[model samples]
Target: MSLVNLEAVHKRFGEFEVLSNINLSVSEGEIVAIIGRSGSGKSTLLRCINGLEPVQQGRITVDGTEVTAANADLNNLRQRVGMVFQSYNLFPHLSVERNVTLALKVVRKTPYAEARDIAHEVITKVGLADKFGAYPDELSGGQQQRVAIARSLAMGPKVMLFDEITSALDPELVGEVLRVLEALAADGMTMLLVTHEMKFAKTVGNRTVFMHEGRIHEEGDSRETLEHPRTPELTGFLDAVLH
Candidate 1:
């Protein structure tokens, strides 16, 4: 069974349809990448999955829990779905350790010491053990984003949603962030990434989905989708971006 399934998903921002007739499924331990032009609803779809943006029609299910319903327990759902954004949204005032531990302590009611230990473990996994006491501004963009990922992992989420997480970084900083994500993918973390990193998408993703005009234009094995694109839209896009 699919870990996430969307059926006829639609979204509108005051009658301007943002997503139309979207249907997609992602299985557990799969890394799926969504690629499209800027306004093609790629980020909106991710937002909808995370409950950051409400869906106007159709259904979205994560681990079989419906996200489109008005009565869905958003807080509960959010805990299972962790998100990383283009900008690493770290709390400037908090140390890296505190940032990672905050959700555990506040939402899960974990004791402070226990949360701190858990935070340390995750930060270590992200290769930031020595920077635990550092603040966001003190770290490089790559380091800060790693902390952000560690924070999300500390939540023990079942799925991770990345919305152009490396788009804002310097060219030199991009690889470090991608390496962290690659490690996560290797560890079988179910991920849905909206990215312009074609190399990573083609190499790391189990599947690649092409979105155009707010709908899925095509989807298939990453190798085939990137190499022998079935749609004219996809062929044009890969040409413009890759060549």
Candidate 2:
């Protein structure tokens, strides 16, 4: 069975359909990227996976737990899934280490000392060991985003969802966040990133999914789908972006 699965998922807000018959699966240790133009439901799909938004129809299963079901333990499910947003979302008043440790201490019930240790380890992994004591306002945009990534990693999630994490960063700063993600990918972390960075989507992901309007228009191996897009929508998108 796939590590992550979404079968015929549908989400609607009032009369507007945000997602339609979306079906996708991600295997363990796979790095998959979802790409599309604006309003393609890319971020909404991630939100559904994390339970931030409820699906009106279909099933979404992560590991073995059903996400779209009402009776499911959402807290337990979220502990196994981590999400990083386009904005850093770090607390300006909290130090980097404190921001990373808050969830561990509050939700996981880990002791202060243990949470601090875990925070230290993840901060170092994200290459911000020295800035652990610094507040979010004191760090560069890229560094702050890395700290946010570390904060999510500290929770020990099985799958990570990145929702256009680089879209808000300066061009030069985007590389730093992408570098951290690349390392995680190299370590075989199961990840799904919603992004418009076509080059990285083509080169780094194990598979690439093209979402158009409110559904997946096409999907396949990264190289094949990006190089030889099968549909007019995908081909036009690639041409508009690459050329």
lDDT of each: 0.93, 0.93
Quantify how close model 2 is to the true structure by its C-alpha RMSD in Å.
Answer: 0.9
**Tens-digit per-residue lDDT, 99-192, candidate 1:** 9999998899999989989998999999999998999999998899899999999999899999999999999999989999999999999999
The sequence of per-residue lDDT tens digits that candidate 2 reaches over residues 1-243 is 799999999999898899999999999999899999899898999999978999999999998999988898889898899889899899888999999999999999999999999999999999999998999999988998899999999999999999999999999999989999999999889999998888899778999999998999999999999999899999998888777
Task: List the lowest-lDDT window of 10 residues for candidate 1.
Answer: 63-72
Candidate 2's C-alpha lDDT?
A: 0.93
Please estimate how well model 1 matches the true structure, expressed as its whole-model Cα lDDT: 0.93
Question: What is the lDDT for 99 in model 1?
Answer: 94
Model 2 misplaced regions, further than 4 Å: none
